[model samples]
Target: MGTQAPSDYSSSAPSKMDEQPEKQAKIDEKLQRQKEIDDWLPITSSRNAKWWYSAFHNVTAMVGAGVLSLPFAMSNLGWGPGIVILILSWVITLFTLWQMVEMHEIVPGKRFDRYHELGQHAFGEKLGLWIVVPQQLICEVGVDIVYMVTGGKSLQKVHKIVRKDEKDSIKLSYFIMIFASAHFVLAHLPNFNSISGVSLAAAVMSLSYSTIAWTASVHKGVQADVDYGYLAHSTSGTVFNFFSALGDVAFAYAGHNVVLEIQATIPSTPGNPSKKPMWRGVVMAYIVVALCYFPVALIGYYTFGNKVEDNILISLEKPEWLIIMANMFVVVHVIGSYQLYAMPVFDMIETVLVKKLNFRPTTTLRFISRNLYVAFTMFVGITFPFFGGLLGFFGGFAFSPTTYFLPCIMWLAIKKPRKFSLSWIVNWICITLGLMLMILSPIGGLRSIIIQAKNYKFYN
Candidate 1:
């Protein structure tokens, strides 16, 4: 038997040697197929928006109700510090965005399609989940709550102007409910890409209202008899006020949570499968953001100084129609924006439940869970209608991590730059700044909230 086996082995040995390269070729082909699958972008024809549309989506994500608070933020920081911080935040955020895009190319097969994906890649999966998901929920849901509070207040203002007799009779909660009802329908839309048109409209609305708010501020400033210089009643030196103001600025510039999602919508071409269009879109969007944000902060603060209300539109004295239109624009814009921010939350929840837990996403479970989440946010918004307080709290506690800390951490972790090198040092500085803001902003926000809550009526 041993002699027979040796005879067969001797006969096939040369053929086996000849087959080695072919086997290796098959393995390589399989690997190439796998790589193709891994690097594949999920974009479909309808979802593949152009760069400009992506830019609009980015603008829509960023320039929501936060713009209305810039003047008050400027008041808290004074013109000097506020302008400096605004520009700095813009630059830093843009740089971090570039880092994020660069990091997308690091992992060979996987894409950081969501914000949490980047965190998961940088750190352990569990820590990334804990780090990114809660902040995203808080930032997005908290922002929606702020929208309800602010939008309701704006609607109340509009009603007061349009129907003065019934102004005191209607409750703010009613307006919130109306807005939420409209959003209930809108939020059910399938995905953010489905609403690119709405996002574009929201971007335009943001510009319209920002311009209105700025023009109104200038109009009021010119009409005033007394000269209120930029630094009047300055609180820049006040420890709590300055940090709180920085939180507002952070909130104004905070769109990182949704950037990856928006970037995924930009169609990748065969020649450029990487995120080059995404970079262009980000640049264009940031330019628009800077243009929209800088003037609003500068002019609103210059006009009203420390007298600037938390909602700048509240500070404006305009014709009834103009005020109503401006405020209504905000209401409409936030109505759309609420869904914009909430989409990430919805996607995250659905993904975890369906993918991890093996729950059915297309079933009633999805509908019920999403609607209930919306209801929960609505309940919270109606319960605490303190707009500025919510803005500051979320900005500090949520936006800081999502907007600043996580980006730096992701870059450092993925790139693994030389220890204590310039990149390392810069990341640490960012991390430190983020930590400081995280600690201080909530305190200031809570103090303001408690102070305001003392006199706040739920439906007033």
Candidate 2:
């Protein structure tokens, strides 16, 4: 009987070959739907921003509390190396950022809006996600956590100046809570364009306070006994400090993390590619970056030298009104920065909840998720407000790849420049530098954190 006839399996059930196509079609349909859902995300929802939006958004993203630390970083590096690192970082990071902008719309009529999406394109879907998401989340969330500490400290600085006797009356933990509270409201603003006003204000405030930081240092003049020597007493400590300082420089130029997202906001077309206006905005932002960084770094170190506080504002104690105002500006600027970074993470979380976890998309979900994120960052900030150490650690460990080398790698992979070509050589050089930064800097940063943690108490 077995030899008599072959079973008509196609009649009983579709053959495996047929099932394959059916499964593939279902997968394609699901992907198409998910793409539609992605459009509603905060990063992609509103694409009506002008070029200036990119300018301030990049400014708000790039210039943060990191600027205040530059002079301190300079103290770690000294005159020659500090100036060289800062300049190279400016040039190299700007190059990497430009590569990111150009890559945003590399494929025809398609935009890699999120950093991970671009990663997916370059490294294959699964590999790209693996490569980029951790780095990106680390960078974004790290910045948010740092901002929490920054905002709280800045607010406390204002309070200290305003109410000299009652400075310790309000706890820093409470101030951080207060800083996180604003995000609970502003996080609901629904997309990048919606928060443009806040970003604009933040951009202005970043410049304002940065001006105050360096100018105040200038007004104070160089310290009477300023020592341009390394802060750490030991050789190993100084080496580590140099590594950590490199991380600080890397962290300072970290606007690249959100460059693709910012570019996503600008409207793109064949003739009028988003890159043109995006580049214009980026150029302007970097100019602001140079203005903010160079003086604060050079003069701040010259003024206070190794004694300069991690936050320059903390060192500027006199001229009560100006210090108070600058600290307030930092508070406002951090408010904008926190939201700018958190927006991308919100999109990711909402995506996972709605798409992966089968949760319905609702305003309540947005509210709850955003609040939890703000709270988590606030807690971390209040617990370990080791600002410089955190920057150095996360800056090199996470930001180095994304900000410094990741873009170049993607460019080399996708563009496939000829060997020894200018593009090829440049990208390789960046990759080498970035890898060194990643490997060496975090060691220093972690050492610093451990040293700081020994003296730190939670919620103090």
Candidate 3:
């Protein structure tokens, strides 16, 4: 039988059916590409994280054990100077952070993923890296050490409360070791984006403990029958103490090192990648930070006056249950926060080890090196448990540059604000303040360390 010619309708129908799957496949492929782009790590991708996540990360970085010292800082500067300095620090830090975000756009088709990169962009690679990287490492590692010491102390406090008779049961070093081991596991998580859940939890824990501390302060203040003085006890003898307090306040607000990294997480919108979301998130986070910080500082100092301990919690004579719970929250928050801060250090070290030293970027290698780094920090914490002095040194030496000096310099270098113009003058003023703080605060901090060393024993 002769084959009948296929009808046009029949031919077209099969053709359309074939094309339907092909078209659908193309659509599926396109969707897959979009998903890859969207699901990519924020460290590498421009836009992956939502602004709220960024805010949570920022808060996690900003709110730490440092907040506990603000009252002691207030005691140093007194209420008037303390409040003024606190506001100024926040304003300057926020402005510098904005400058950092603004500089990201100055060079088209390039993004500054890390603070050191911005430093290298502004200055030569060697000089910029040297200026920023060491300070950043110091600040971050110092913070982790602080977390270890503070967390161990807090856990010890809780232990003493819960086990009253067993107050001297275990050494602080044991608690620090336990904390470090916990951090070792979490620190293995690949990057910042991977820790969003932990960051959010850390932020919540920060708020929880801070609220408890603040409430306790108010209650103590109201119930006490002591004279409240808004100023320091004596101005002349406590000059160094005053600066030490200033260093503490500066330290409390010294999350500027990670600001750009945190901002990197904010997802960019289509056709408009300006930093509106980042700015909004920053403003919101800082507002929450101020609310958390101010009341605690004011009320704690008001309650204890010159008698306030470096950590306000140390001074509180609250119910053992409440204090233990608050300290436990602190330990929990710091556990997550240690990972948050340490991740950047891990990225830096791993990049160098893999790229420069040719170490394979395998999971085992990462786990090993990262845990070793944690071990080193643990050793430091155990060897020197001077929490207050460490805070001072890190805040003054590391934070002064990472938080203040380098940002101004990078802004000046990248933006090249006109000579004697408002931007120039403002940045110069900031630079001057940074230099002054850098020079003086460290000296005071060193003095504090010397004084503290007299009574401090290893693993005490």
Name the candidate that leads on TM-score: 2
Which scores better on TM-score, 1 or 2? 2
Q: CA lDDT of 9 in candidate 1?
A: 88
lDDT of each: 0.77, 0.90, 0.79
Give candidate 3 regions above 4 Å deviation: 1-42, 45-47, 222-237
User: Pairing residues by index, what is the TM-score of model 2?
Assistant: 0.93
TM-score of each: 0.86, 0.93, 0.87
Comparing 2 with 3 on lDDT, the higher-scoring candidate is: 2
Q: What C-alpha lDDT, on a 0 to 100 scale, does residue 319 get in candidate 3?
A: 72
lDDT of 3 by residue, 1-460 (tens): 2344567556756776688899999999979755553233335444577778767777888889999988878876777888898888888888887787677656776667788888889898899898889898888898999899999888877887778776458998998988888887888777687888888888888888888888998876553554445344455437777667767876887677777777666665446664777777777788878877888888887788767888877887577778888898898889888887887788788777765786655778877888899999999999988777777777888787777768888888877889999999999998998888887777667778888898777666
Q: Considering every candidate listed, which one attains the maximal lDDT?
A: 2
lDDT of 2 at 152: 90
Tell how far residue 13 is off in model 2, in angstroms: 13
